[model samples]
Each structure stands twice: as C-alpha cells, then as structure tokens.
Target: MLLFITIGALCLLLTIVGDLVKLLQLSKLFRCISGSACSDELQQQLKEARVKVERVRQSSNATSHYTYTVKLMRAENELKAIQTKLRNESNMQNLKGASVELVVGYLLKGVLSLVLFIITLRNRYTPVFLFNENINFEPLEGLLSFPTGVHNAISVPFWALSCNSAFRLLFNAIKGK
Candidate 1:
C-alpha cells in the first residue's frame, strides 16, 4: 500500500538522520577539531606554568637555600593550579556537551515516535500488506490482521516495527559495528 510504503520510508529517513546527527557530534567536533582559542590559550598557559616550575627547580640544588625552596614551591603550586583548571575545563565541556546531546536525542526520539504513533492509530484498520495463505498460524494471523480483522493481512504497527528493525540492522551492519 502507498500509505505503508510512505510510512516505512519516513521511519527509515528518521533513523538515518538520527544516526547521522549522532555521528556528527557537533559539540565535541567543534571543541576537538580546532580546540579553538580558549582551549589553545589554556594549553599555552599550561606550558608556561610547567616551564616556570622547571626554571625555578633548575635555578638551585634540590636542598639549597630557603628562598629557593619558597620559589620552587610557589612555581609548583602555580603549575598544579593551571593543570587543575585545564582538567576541570575539559571535563565540564565534555559533560555539558554529552548532556545536551542526550537531551536532544531523547526529545527527537520521543517526538518522532509520537508522530508515528498518531499515524499508526489513524491507520489502525488499514492493511499494510495482504497475503493469501502465506502464514497459517492462527494467533499470528489474528495479530497481523489487528484492527482490520482481515486474515493474513499485516497491519501498520508490525510494518512500522519491521521497518525500524530492518533499517537499524542494516545501518549497524554498514557501520561495521
């Protein structure tokens, strides 16, 4: 049926689009691809902090003057502070990005599934495919016929499920995962 085919295509399209969006991973892509100005600046600061600590350490023997100890401790503390800042910044960005992606993925799935549900309800009495003695199982025939009460006819709900299952399986196979 045209309705069945169109609905199947829509489901396939949505599944592909959702996977593509997941693959894009835009937030992490932007942050990782360029690691842009802010991250670069932080990296530069981290390097300078390490250099400062090393310079101070090299300025004196490990057990030299009290002034040297104070300088070395201060430099090391600065280096540690910078390292912690960089770690925290990266962790926060990852958490925020993942959270946003999770929320968006959840909403997209919910809304699209809702649309499919509405369509299925509207076409509850419609037969997605008609068969003549193709399947002889009574319970299955009863279920496949669904609201239409037509023996050996598949309904929209099962068709939708089959479409989603087949497409997702094909997609994963193509992705080699």
Candidate 2:
C-alpha cells in the first residue's frame, strides 16, 4: 500500500513537472517573437516558432496522457494483486465486502488528512481577530483556499469512484464469470 501510494505521488509529481516544463517552453517560444514584425524574415521565424510550439505542445500532451494511462494500469494491477493475496490468505468469500471496507478506510484517511492539512494551513496563515474589531484580508487567501477546496472536493470523489469501479472489476475477476 505504501509502495502504491509512493508510485501515485511520483506519477503526480512527474505530471506536474511535465506540465510546467511544457508551459515554460511555450512561453519561451512566444517570447522569441516579441520584436517589431511584418518583415519577411521575422514573419518566417514567427511561423516556424508557432509550428514548433504546437508540435511540442502536442507531444507533451501525448506523453502526459501515456504516463497517466500507464500509472493507472499499474495501480489497477496492484489493487488486483492485493485482492488476490487477501483471498489466498483467507478463505473469506466476501471479497466485495472487504473491498468496500478498504475503500471506506482509504476515503476516511484521505479526508482526515485533507482536513488536518487545511486546518494547519489556516492556523498558520489566517489572522485571528479579536472581538471583530478589525478584519484583515490577505490577497493570497482566495488563491490558497480555492485550490485546496477544489482538490479535496474533486479528487476524493474521483478516487472513491475509481476504487469502486476497480473493486467491481476485481469481483468479476474473482468469480471467473
């Protein structure tokens, strides 16, 4: 489980790094065309730069997609292996039940971690006002809150659903139906 978590984290990091690199490269490509234009040579250079940026963007996108697919498949395989191991170790017939328990455990842990992180961050950065005498608003609050809220709200449900689907497939595999 720890290994799977680490792999997932690494995959996420790689995806983010790949995205940032692509964006930076695209920015540089755009910056290359910032001079006074309309000359034939300048126009040709801009056209070529645009083409190269497009190609780079497409390739990066394809690579990102491929990496995600591979990671997902690997995760699925790991889950399947866990299920098999559990079955072989115990003669329990309630594989679905066990899967449900596993999913619930994961969801609870993830949500708790998110809540703790948010609380810690809020405590660290948010100013505590006394008696509502004065209020201070930081410009970065919205930026920070939006992503944390969005990630916790979106990713938890997405992962839960994916786990449920994966468990269903595992069930099917187990029944040999």
Name the candidate that leads on lDDT: 1
The residue pairs in collision within model 1 are none
Q: Candidate 2: give the clashing pairs.
A: none
Model 1, CA-based lDDT: 0.80
Candidate 1: where are CA atoms >4 Å away?
Answer: 9-21, 30-37, 61-64, 133-139, 162-177
On TM-score, the leading prediction is 1
Residue-wise lDDT of candidate 1 within 4-106, one digit each (tens)?
A: 8778876887677666567779668645754467778889998998898888878887556998989988998888988888898888778777776677777
Q: What root-mean-square deviation over C-alphas does model 2 reach?
A: 27.5
If scored against the real structure, what TM-score would every candidate get? 0.74, 0.20
Q: Write the per-residue lDDT of candidate 2 for residues 68-171, one digit (tens) a residue.
A: 56655655555555555544433332443345444554565565446534544444333221222253325533433342343112232233334445644665
- List where candidate 2 sits over 4 angstroms from the true fold: 1-93, 125-177
**What's the CA error at residue 80 for candidate 1, in Å?**
0.7
CA RMSD per model (angstroms): 4.0, 27.5
**For candidate 1, what is the TM-score?**
0.74
